[model samples]
Target chain A: MSAQPVPLVPVLAVVGIGLIGGSFAAALRRAGQVGRVLGVGRRQASLDRALALGLIDEVVDLEQAARRADLILLATPVGAMRAALEALGPHLRPEALVTDAGSTKADVAAIARAALGERLRQFLPGHPIAGSEMTGPEAAHPALYHGRKVVLTPLAETPVRARDWLTRVWEACGAHVLLMDAERHDRVLASISHLPHLLAAAYMAQVSREGDADLRLSLAGTGFRDFTRIAAGSAEVWRDIFLSNRESVLDELAAFERVLGELRKTLEDPDPRALEAFLEQAALARRLWDGRSAMT
Target chain B: MSAQPVPLVPVLAVVGIGLIGGSFAAALRRAGQVGRVLGVGRRQASLDRALALGLIDEVVDLEQAARRADLILLATPVGAMRAALEALGPHLRPEALVTDAGSTKADVAAIARAALGERLRQFLPGHPIAGSEMTGPEAAHPALYHGRKVVLTPLAETPVRARDWLTRVWEACGAHVLLMDAERHDRVLASISHLPHLLAAAYMAQVSREGDADLRLSLAGTGFRDFTRIAAGSAEVWRDIFLSNRESVLDELAAFERVLGELRKTLEDPDPRALEAFLEQAALARRLWDGRSAMT
Candidate 1:
């Protein structure tokens, strides 16, 4: 497989032309891995902006783009996946490969199963673990996904050829592709990605609602700034994610609350040894992770 | 007061020569504002390290150092403040100015009042809003407090001369000094610094205790890194902080729990508009804070 030459995608349709979609189109165009990149979105102004920025070669309707394309990249929010799949279902080419950049994979897989039916074999569910606080076509950059992890959760019905092709494409855009079960992907993401986001949001909401919020914010420094950075992400995008992966997110939240309660008890009772031990364990784990991540 | 010329201390003693104490000594030395810097700590090895690093001119016992010094800086943890003050109280020079670099001011003020009695008038409680994950004598740098905020929570019994002298000293080290009530300082810190630290520790405890912790940590990226970075802080240090300001921390913890419960409800009920509104408020607040903080 490594020795085989990968063929260029004759035509690529990128739905939702925002940060993820725009970055993907820009990267592929920069690599010259696609013949023509067609951007599809509900907003004509956004599509026009993406075209003007040279992120896409043309703007086309979902049906027309899907009918002419050899590949379709669904980069919309998780809530829009079902409708997007439905719109492309009738005109989707038999040989076209479909993939997505949604945060939640299980829901995307389920939506693909319901909407694509037999065409599900050609669909590969993926999520690139790269983003910024900024969104839209203007925020798009060719190096956004460079040196990032792009996870693929292929359905049981998905073809080996389709998965291999999608892996090659993501590699061309400078991402390392890893394959995992959809359920496992969602659970892993809930612990690392979804949980941190919710915790930051909760912290921001708490601080902002305080009686001395202005004073508190004025005193907040670098630590507060970095910790709440993700809480400033796209609200519409994150809300859709929270609802889409509700069960996993709730499980993680409960785990976090239980630990918080334990910490509160330690603080209230003033157990120096116990509190030190708990904090030491956490600090050790974080340091170990930091050391290992730097190497990898 | 602003027109007054700041007097140079003939001899200065810095108790507990860790990051805060070491940095203070180094910055004063760099500014050429002190005659001789005396380092005080239980550990001779740490004092030797500070002396070798040129952070202090010599090592001396706390009582002897306090008796000979024109100024004293207590840079130990809040838990150690009472014992530190008690040791210095009997031998402290009558004309000496004293201050502390504790994170929580109310407890430190109470400790000083109880320990120093008549000497409390010379003790001005302060907290420098500057630190790194790094600690100890080796981590000390001359520019550590440059462009930072140093908050002073002076007691009603504190002498105006002592407060003014301490403010001038901090300003000489390139810090902006602000004065507030001790109770207000604890509350504001609880909302910003203390609360964020607890949340990060809790999140880290939850994730590290999971059965698939290795996998979860491996998948963790920049967001997770930034969110949990403070969790890697000194265990003994934070444990002391949490216990020192327990009431204010508990109040902030309860507030965070309430907001988190609201977010969980929105997730469970699947209200797009409600979820978006909550997230939008948080995002807007963070962005606004970021903009204002950058300007300041």
Candidate 2:
């Protein structure tokens, strides 16, 4: 179904004003689709920075912001999302549309379902597949979501109005929106995004534990740098992601391990042809994927 | 001991005129430190391209080129080094200083010792820690090795004159030369370079074999791109590397598996604190290493 036309939101409340939240607020403000944006977070300094950068018009308490908002965007970590929803629950206007920008959709959906109770229809779970190896308000930019995919997992109980408004808002921010079930969204992301992050972290940890790690680090060049760049992401953030999406992440890890096992066996047996074939398959697949990505 | 001052070499022969060899020829030519560079390869078209690009002055056969050279550079794959060295053996001039740009030094060293026989003293196994996912003479650039590390794994029987001349030549090309034993060089590279390449290949292979691979690939972002960039390298070249350095690469793979096993257990057990700590350690280590690399 096509998204219905929605007018400018009177007031938008963005909780957890870090990279994702700040970027959303900035994008909305730049598009002139939000009359005023209110930033809410535990960190006063972060909220103040967001306001100063014009990402938001003002910093306000969560409950107060919820009361004033025509729409509320939950942009906290999935782990912190439950508490934010609970605190905003009582203060939320009866007609307010609620949405989130979390990585793991299933967990966030469950949390929202439990906390929002009767207001579940207002909650739309979204994940903007956009970011850098960066965080905080300083790292936020208006174009962060431009030309990126933003998947929305709207519950069966979700109102059509809420889903359509959220879609229109993300589209205004230059995001290409796709709709999917929470479970499928989580599984797909686990395979592509989460698994790669954990692998990079594990590789880095392995190298750091080496006897001659210092020497190895010295010899690391551009290849190593690119491969492990995601390992340098915030620990607190990734930890939440790994745990929240543990099941799917574990499945992907198991699949990767199996492939690695096959490769290890080939290496041990010294099968030149098999090894070459395996590497060739991977190289060809990656090149094809890269070509398609560049085109899109 | 210090490197001795060496005059311009009258003739230099570069076998396997691909990325590494072509770049070396171009750099030496740009520095005006060599009178003439002869390109030797199985592909006449590649050698002709090198000559046309001014990377070499002429194209010749291995034996013919070896006989006319004051210096010989074996710049082929590690697997091909043995055959190349054997072919150049009978035609080598007595005073010719020989070096290589192989990825795995231990394998190259063993091959050199076996094929060069009495002339092993003139052979220095070298690896220029510089390359791109691209290969071939067309990808060659004079500045490819500038400010890059060039590791030379000199054998015990290697003559000081051979080592000195090779070191000076690489220095003229703007590479910082470091000396180490072949075993140590291989082990260090296995930990840093080879291990990461195998990991990237494994990850790419895993994703490619997935049921919904196209979907997963569409969801991939910059993180996946950077992580798998090396996986797009020449399959023939990397396969040889993996096989030639099988022992060391397997050791690294085992170590990585152990770390991954621990991470998996932690994930299964649902330990948020433990998981956070693990991610934190890796992030800290990667950041510190990146800081040092940037400074250098």
Candidate 3:
């Protein structure tokens, strides 16, 4: 879970300096691993706020960032990765390695392959699993990634120097870093992350679409509150995740539907033992997950 | 959210003194609204724990409770209501009103009708909306019901004095008491509570059944943790709820499946706008709910 110390980078660039990117910049600054931080994004107002908050040393264009930064971290929504990578591709100085904090890996990898062309080996796909209901520059904090897992998906041909350096950077930010391939990372995340978000949003939509939505919401207890917490995630971000990780998410959804269908059939006759056994499996599994999670 | 003071009951009995029942006893004791509490349940070990935890003054049989108590709270699972009511029927003296903390109500009312006979009017069906991932007597606390909603479903034939007295007691226990009918309560709860629990359990079952479930779970973050928390609820308890409230829960499930089906089709085309719009609606509604819920 720990990584050896690495030298500070001369200049670091962050694309889409929202919670993830902004927090990364702050954490790296706190760890004294970056000499200067450059922010790049479409939103000038947000970038201004990040600059004012000292999350970044300066706000710069993508071209300037690619030319100057020793490391470039893409933290934009998954949907924007293509354009951002393409923009960063042309002006990249040699040894200017790029990494991303995207939620999914396979699509980002594919996009990087096509967009970065010969520089694809320099593009490391990663997902930093941080929890936040809020977004934007204001929500970013140094401790955002503390004790969190950061999965790095690097192609086989990527330079070990670059991979090991990024791993140390994340570890310096108080993260537990793990190496994974793009396909494996995507498959793991599709089950644990993507499908749950989809289900939560879908459930919320169903409740809100009800004739007595306000009344139903009024009667909602703590269970409803917790179950739908993830449904409040940024819509644009989730849309890109679901679309980019389409096949895996759909497969997970179908698997969930099968279980749901079985439970539905159990409810038809509603055999007491059958229902209890079905519920027991889930309850036991969920309880075990919590127990192990607490240990970790 | 505040209620006027109500005088203490001389003696009260709580059936199945787990989280809900034991917590109610503790809250009533803290409010100085109960002179003594008698616990009744099938598990002697649990009853002993309740006695040791000071959740109950003494352990007693249903007959002893029926004869000695001024009020009785049937806080057992909804499936056990009929058996409890049938047991309490013969020995119940006049004015010894009964209430419940069962999650589902319409079915409880029907069961009360059959089991309690002439004493049906004495039963005041209720549900106290409290949040907890843990259960048993050890989980009981005086503040468990503070600022929480306790919905009371009283029959028209039930005496006004009984309804008013129970409402005052719940308020004294620091709950916001709301008046509702059995059918309406069931429908509302089915939509919010029951459906969410079912979906969570189904999602958990699906994930656990996967070939690489351990790996997927190891990568689970905060979102998955929150979304699946309710799935860890007591299997026996949830089974009873799903069975007792089958019709309403099934209705809610069908409604959810309709929205889910539309989402499935949208995922098929992977249309950006449609997917974004769908997620946007859910995100907006969920955010609004949190804002209002915070105020309440």
> What local distance difference test score does each model get?
0.88, 0.88, 0.89
Model 1 chain B scores worst on lDDT over the 10 consecutive residues at B1-10
Across residues A1-296, which tens digit of lDDT does each residue of candidate 2 receive? 13634447879999888889889888887787878788888987887788788888888887898789998888887888888889888888988988888889998989988998998887889999998867899998889999999999999998887888889999989899999999988998998889999999999999999888998898889999999999999999899899889999998998998998888888998888899999999999999998999887
Q: What are the candidates' individual DockQ scores?
A: 0.77, 0.86, 0.83
Please tell me which model should have the higher lDDT, number 1 or number 3.
3
Name the regions of candidate 1 deviating beyond 4 angstroms: A1-8, A29-32, A42-53, B1-7, B30-32, B43-45
Model 1 C-alpha lDDT per residue in residues A123-236, reported as the tens digit of each score: 899999998867899999989988888999988998888899899999989998889998888888999998899989889988988777988888888889878988988898
Candidate 3 clashing pairs, residues 3+ apart or interchain: none
Instruction: Please state the CAPRI-style docking class of candidate 3.
Output: high
Q: For chain B alone, what TM-score does every candidate structure achieve against the true structure?
A: 0.94, 0.94, 0.93
| lDDT for predicted candidate 3 compared with the true structure | 0.89
Model 3 bad stretches (over 4 Å): A1-8, B1-8, B42-54
The complex in candidate 2 yields a DockQ of 0.86
For candidate 1, what is the total of clashing residue pairs? 0
- Write the residue-wise lDDT of candidate 3 on A1-296 in tens digits: 14645446769999988889999999988887888899998988998999999999888999999999999999887778899899899999988899998888888888999898998888888899885878899999999999888999989768998899889989989999989888888888989999888889889999998888998898787889899999998888788888888998898888889999999999987788988998999999998999988876
